[model samples]
Target: MTDYRAAVQDMNFLLHDVFQVSQDWATMPELAEMMDADTARAILDEAAKLTETLIAPNARQADEQGISFKDGEVTTPDGYKEQFAQLAQGGWVGVTANPEFGGMGLPKTLSAQYEEMMCAADISFSLYSGLTAGAIMTLDLHASQELKETYLPRMAAGEWTGTMCLTEPHCGTDLGILRTKAEPQADGSFALTGTKIFITGGEHDLVDNIVHLVLAKLPDAPAGTKGISLFLVPKFLVNEDGSLGERNPVVAGSVEHKMGIHASATCVLNFDGAKGWLVGEPNRGLAAMFTMMNYERLGVGIQGLGAAARSYGTALEYALDRRQGRGAKATQEPQAEADPLIVHGDIRRMLLTMKAFVEGGRAFSTYVGQQLDRAKYAATEQDRADAEALVQLLTPVAKAFMTDTGLEATIAGQQILGGHGYVREWGQEQWVRDCRIAQIYEGTNGIQALDLLGRKVAGSRGELLKPLLREMTEFLQADAGQWSAEYQQLADAVKSLTEVTEAVLAQVPSDENIINSVAVEYLNLVGYVVYGYLWLRIARVAEAQDALGEFASSKVKTAKFYFAKLLPRIHSLRPSIEAGSKELFSHELNEF
Candidate 1:
C-alpha cells in the first residue's frame, strides 16, 4: 500500500494537456487567477504528499482497531483524529466549496484529484470530510442566506462536520414511503422527528458540532416523493450570534457493524422533536437533496477508482517480489532456482487487465469532473447547459461503471496474490471489502444503471446524450492522425453504441420493463465506448512522448490491449440488450 501512487501525473496530463482546462478556466471570470497548469499540478503534488505520507499510514490502524461506539458516541482510531485535523487545516475539506464562505473555491476538475488521492490514502477517514463537502455544496445552493451565512463558514472550514440522512428503517431507494414527520414552529423552523438509518458520519468525535441534512415530510405535504422536504438539523443548536447552544434532540441510536470501513461510523440517527430549517421549497426536497447526492455520486465513483488504483499498485508489487514461476519462453535465467511471478503470462494478463481499466477509468472520471467544472463556471449559458446535460447523462455511468469495474479490478488483484491475499495483513482483501460498499451505497450499481437508461437516456429520448456523443464524434473527426487506427476503432464503437441507444429508446416506451431489463447492459455498452475514446486520447498523448521510451510505450501498449481485449465485451452486451425483457420475466415467482 505504501508503494501506491495517486496517478497525479496522469491526472495532470488529462487536465492540462489533453483537456486544456486551464484555457477553459482562463475564459471564465471566476477561475482565471487560479486556473493555470502550474497551480493545478502543484495542488495535486501537495495532495499526493499529504495522502501518501500522513493519511495512508493511518488506514491499517483504523481498519484493524475499528471505531468504538458507547453511549451514542463513536470514537475513531488513535491516529485518525490528528490526521483528520491536518486534513482540515490544509483546507482540503472544502477544496471546491464557495469562496465567499471560506472555501478554497477550486474547480471540480482539480478537486476531483484531491478527492481521489484522499480516498486512496484512507477512505474511512476520508468519508467524514467527503460527506461534509457534499453537505456544504447543497447548503450553498439551496439553503437560505441566513443559514448559509451561519453554517457554510464553519462547515467549509471543517470545524463542524456534516452528514446526509436519507435512508429509514424500511425505506431505502423508495423514498416515497418514508415516515419522517416535520412540524412547523412559529419561529419559521421545523420540528423534525424521524429515525434515519445508514447515515455515514452521523455522530463522531472528530467534530464538536455535526450538521445533518435530513429529509422529512411536512404535515400537509403531498403524497410520495413530492411530500418529502430537506432540512438542516444540527447536533447542537446554533445561537443567533453563531455560537453553540444546548444539544439538540438528535442522537446516534446505534452503530452498524460492517464488514469493512470500520473506521467510519455508520449510525442509525434518531431525531426526537429536533429543531431544523427548510432547505428549499416544500414538496421539492428530493430535488434539493439531488444537489448533494449528485455530488456524492461522483465522489463515490472516485472512491471505487481509488480502490482499484491502490489494489493494482499492491498486486503489481507482490507479482514483482514473489519468486516462483519462470517465463513462458525463458531460455535462461540469472538465478536458475526460480523467477518472479511477473514472468508468467497469466499473471501478466491479470496485471494488464487491472492496468487497462484503472487507467481508462482515470481518464473517464477526469473528463466527467471537467464537465462538472464547466457546468459551474463556463462563460456562456449554452456552454453551461451543454455541460450540465452531459453531467446529467454521465453521472450514473461514472457511479455505476466505475464501481462495477473497480470491484472486478480489486478481485483480480486479490487473485493475483493467491493465498496471501485472503489473509488480513496483506490488505488486498481489505481493498475488496472497502470497495464493495461503494457499489451498494450512494445508489446501487443496478439503480444507477436504471437511472442512466430511464431518466438520462430514454426519458430524454437520447437528447441528453447528444452533447457527449457529439463530443466523441468531433474528437474522432479532429486531426488525431498519428493514432488513426485506434481512434477509428473507437469511432466504430461510438457509432454502434449510438444505434443501440436509439433502439433501446424505441423499445422503452413500448415495453414498460425495457429500461430496467436493458439498463445494466446499456450502461456497460456506453462505458466501453466511453473508455475506448479515452484510451485513444491517452495513446495519442503517449505517442507524442516517445522520447520518454518505456513509460510512453507502455501507455500505447495498454491502449492497444484495452481496445483489443476489453472493448469487445460491449458487443456481447448489445444482443442481450436488444433481446429485451421477455426472457427475464418468463419464469414466475413460484417457478423458482
Candidate 2:
C-alpha cells in the first residue's frame, strides 16, 4: 500500500484563494485572535505530516487485528494507544473547543482540513478523536457551567473520550420508539436505565473514562420523541475535587463485529440505574443532540472524501508506475513492450472522475465550514441567522451527496486496480468497505435527501434554498473573464434546479409520497450543481494565479471535466425528480 499524502496544496488553495478566510477572519474577532493565513497553513502541514507518517502505515495492521472484547472490556489494536496519545498530546481532539477551557478554538474551516487528513490516513483511528471533538462541542453548547468545568478541559486534554448513544435494539431512526427510561433521584440527579447499541467509542482502553451523551425519558413525561431528554452519563462518577470516583452502573455488554472500522469500538452499552446529570431542559434532547449530530454528519461526509482521496492517490500511483497494455497512440515504451495504464482513455476517465469529485467535494466542504464560522462568529444577529439558514439548507446535501458519490468514487478507484483492488493487500478494498458506512450512518443519505426536499426546501416554502441559488447567481453574474461559457452552463444548471425545486413544491400539495420517492434524485441534482459552482470557482482562482504553474493548469482541466462530463448528470436526475412518485406507487403491494 502506498503512503497517504494529504492534499495540502488544494486545501491551501481553497482556504486562501477560493474562500479567502484571511479576509473573513479579519471581520470576526474570535477567528482573528486565533491565527493568520501562515499559521493556518502551518497547522495543515503539521497535521499532514503527523497522520501520513505515524497513522497511515499502521491502518492495515490495525484493521487486520481489529478490536478485542473480553470480560466487558474493549481494547484497540497494537500501536493505537501510542498513536492516540500523540493525538491527545497535540490537543487535536479539542481543535474547535472553547479556548477558555484549554482548547485551540480554531475555525472549523481549518479543523475540517485536519479531519480530512486524519480520515485519509485511517478513518478508524480518526473516529476516536472525531467523536471526542463532536462530544466536546455538544457539551460546550448545552451542558451547565459545572459540567463544562468538570469535563470539557479533561476531554479537551484527551484524558477521556466521549460517545453519543441514541440507538436501541428496536429503534434506529425513529427515536420515538426508544424504550430507555430515566428516573429522578433524591440527589437532584437522574438514574438512567437503558441499553444503547451501535455506540462508537463506547468502551475503549485508549482513555481513562468515557463520557456518554445519552437520550431517555422520565416516567410522567409525554410519550414519543417529545418526552426524551439528554443526560451526561460518565463511566465513573466524578468527585468534588474533579477526580475519578466509583464506577457508574453503565458497562459495555459487548462489542459488535462489524464490516469496517474494525479498529474503532462499536459497543452495546447497558446503563443500569446509572447516575447522570441532565445536560439541558427536559424533553428537548433531540434539539440539543443535533448540535453534535450536525457536526458529526459533516465529519462523516469528510470521512468519505478522505477515503476517496486516498483511493485516488493509490490508484493514480499504481496507474503511473505499473506497466500495462499498449496505448492507442505510438508507444513511448517500445523497448519495454508495454505502456503505463495512464495511456488508456478509460483509466484517464476514472482518474479524472475521482479528481473531479474529490477536489470539488473539498471545496464544497470548505464552503460549508465557512458558513459554520459565520453562523458562530458573525457580528450581527441577522448575519448569523442568514449563515445558519445556509448551514441548515446545505448540511443534508453535504452529508448525503458527498457520501453517496463518495462511495461511488471509492468504487471507481478500486475498479482502476481491477483484481488487485479486490484484495486487501493494496488497501483499496478496505476503503470501499469503510466508505460504505458513511452513506448509511450519520442519518442515512436517503433521510438526508428527505430532509433536503421535504423539510428544508418544502418546509420553508423554498426560502432555505433561495440563499444558495442567489449566491451562485451572483457569482455567475460577476466578471469571470475567460470562463464565460462554463459560467453559462452553470447558469443553466442553476436554472434547472430552480425549476425542479418549484415543480416539487407545486406537486407536494397533492402527491403525499412525492418527496420520499424522488428525494434522493433531487438531492443529487442539487449536489451536482453545487459541485459545479465550486469547481468553476476553483478553476477561476487557479487560472488567475500566475505563480501556481501546473497546479493551476490541473485545476482548470479538472473543472472542465466536471462541467463537460459530470455536471451533466443533473440533466438525467432532473427528469427523474420531475416524474414524481406516481410510478413508485403504481405497483400493488402484492405485485412483486
Candidate 3:
C-alpha cells in the first residue's frame, strides 16, 4: 500500500495554495464559519486513514472474489460490509450533503478532495457511497418536500444507499428512444414499469434500504426527452411516520459480471408496477436527472484521476526497488549487479509524466469544485452566472480529459512495471481494468467530446469560451516575466485552438456531421492545451516561492516536457476538425 498521508498533503497544496478554496468558502456566509482549513484538513486525515487502512487492503481480494449472486441475493466480498458500517458510522457518505437531511454540510470543494482519496484507495468500495452522494444531490434539488423529509435524512445518514436508474436495455445515451412507462394511479403515486441496466450499487447488503431515482415516461407525456419524468422508488417504502413499510415492486433481476470493479454490483433492475412518487413535476424528469448525471460525470472523471494516482504510486515504488540498467551518470557503484530502475531516463520520463498529470488533475478538480461552490453560494448574481458558465464549460473537460489522461498514465505506470504489470498479483493490471470504465461510463469520452465542441464552443457562438479564455490569458500574463517561454507556448496553443474552434463552428452550422466527425480529436486538442496551461501555472507558483527541491524542480521540468512534447498535439487536431463531415457521413449502411 502507498502512503496516503502524502496524498493528503498534495491535496492540501492544491486546495489552499493553488486554488485557495478556503478563501472562496469563507466568502459565503452560510459556509464561511462552518468550514475552515483546519476542519477540512482533519476530515481529510481521517478519510485517508480509513481508506488506506481499511478499504484499500481489500481491493485486490474483492476483485478476485467478485460479487456472488445466489437466488436474487447479491453478496459482496467479506469485510466490505463491516468496512461499510465503519464508513457510515464515520459520516463519510454525507460529507457534502445538505444539513437539513442530517448531513454534515461540508463544501463540495473539500468533499471532492476526500472523494478522490477514497477512490484512489479503493474505487470498487467507493462506488457504494459515491452513488448515494450523487443521488442525494439530485433529490435535494428536485425531490418533493415530503420525499426529501422522508428519504434524504436516512440516505444521508447512510442507513440507506442510492442508485440512479437511467440507462435501459434499449437506450444508454439516446433517452428519446426509451420505452419505460409510469402510469398515474387513483392515489398520488404512479406505477413504474421498466427495465434499467448497468445500475451501480443497485442491490447490496451494505445498507438497510436502497433508493432509486428512476427516469420514466408518463402515458400522456410528449415524445423524446421532453416526456421523461423522475421518480423516487425505494426498496422499502416509507410509511407516514417515516418507518420502513412494505417492499416496492422494484427488484434486481440479475447482477453483471464486468471487466473490472467487480465488488461494486451492477444490476439489471426490473420494475413491475413499482409504486413510485414523482420527484419533480411531470414531463420534467430529464431535467431533474441532469442534476445527478452532471454530478456523477465529474465524479467519474475523478475516479480516473484516483486510479491513475494509485497506479503511479505503486509503479514508482516498484521502480525504486526493482534492479535494472545502470544510471545515465554512472558512479563507482557500477561494480554492483545492477542499478534501480529509477536511474534510467525513460523510467524518469514515465514517472514525471504521471506526476505532472496527477498534480495537474488535482488542481483542475479543485478548480472545478471551487466553481461549483461559487455557483451555489456566491453572493452576487453575476458571480453566480460566471461560476455556472465555467462549470458548464469545464464539466465535460473534467470528465473526458481527466479520464483520458488517467488511462494513459495508468498504462504508462503498467509499462514501467514491465512483465510484472501483466500478472494479477502485482495489481497493476487491476488498475488498468478499473480505470477503463471511467472512459465508457458517465457518457463515453466520445460523447463528452461532442458535448464540448457542440454545446460549449459552437452552441452559443463561443460565449462560454470568452470567460475561460480570459481566465487562462490573465493567469499567463500575470507571470509572463518569469516563465515567459512556457507561458507563451501555452498562449499560442490556446490561440490556435480558439481559432480552430471558430473555424469549425463557422462550418458546423451548415454541416451537423462535422461535430461527430471531429469531436474526439477536438477534445484531445483542448485537453492538452488546458493541461499545458495548468503546468505553466504550477511552474510559476514553484518559481515564485524559490522552491528548488525535488518537488519544485520536477514541476519545472514537467512543464518543459509538457510544452515541448504535449502541446504540439494540438496542431494535429486542427485539420481533423476542419475536414468537414463528408467522409464519416459518406459511409454506406451495407459497407459494414
Best by TM-score: 2
lDDT of 2 by residue, 1-592 (tens): 8988999999998999999998888899888877899999999999999999999999999999999999999989999999999989998888998998999998989988999999999999999989999899999999999999999999999999999999999999899889889999998899999999999999999988999999999887798889889999999999999989999999999998989999989999999999999988999898999999888888998998999999999999999988888988665677887899988889999999999989988998899999999999988889999999999998999998888878888999899999999999999999998898899887889999999998999999999999999999999988968788899999999999999999989999899999999999999999999999999889888998979999999999999999889998888898898898989898887954
* Every candidate's lDDT: 0.89, 0.92, 0.86
Model 2 spans with C-alpha error above 4 angstroms:
589-592
Poorly placed runs, candidate 3 (over 4 Å): 1-6, 329-332, 546-549, 586-592
Give one digit per residue, the lDDT tens place, for model 1 in 1-592. Answer: 4455778877887887677889988988999986688988899999999998898877887899998999999998998878878888999888878989999998888888888888777789889999999999999999999999999999988899999999999999999999999999999999999899999999989888999999999999999998999999999999999999999999999999998899999999999999999998898989999988877999999988898889899999999888885676653266567788888888888999999988888888889988988898889999999889989989999999998999899999999999988987778898899999999998899999999989888888888888788988998987867667777788888888888888877776679988898899989998989998888888888788767588779888999899888998887998998899999888787853
lDDT of 2: 0.92
Candidates in order, TM-scores: namely 0.98, 0.99, 0.97
Q: Count clashing pairs, candidate 2.
A: 0
**Candidate 2: clashing pairs of residues:** none
User: Can you write out model 3's per-residue Cα lDDT over 344-405, one digit (the tens) per residue?
Assistant: 88998898888877888887888788888899899899998999998888888899999999
The TM-score of candidate 1 is 0.98
The Cα RMSD of model 3 versus the native structure comes to: 1.7
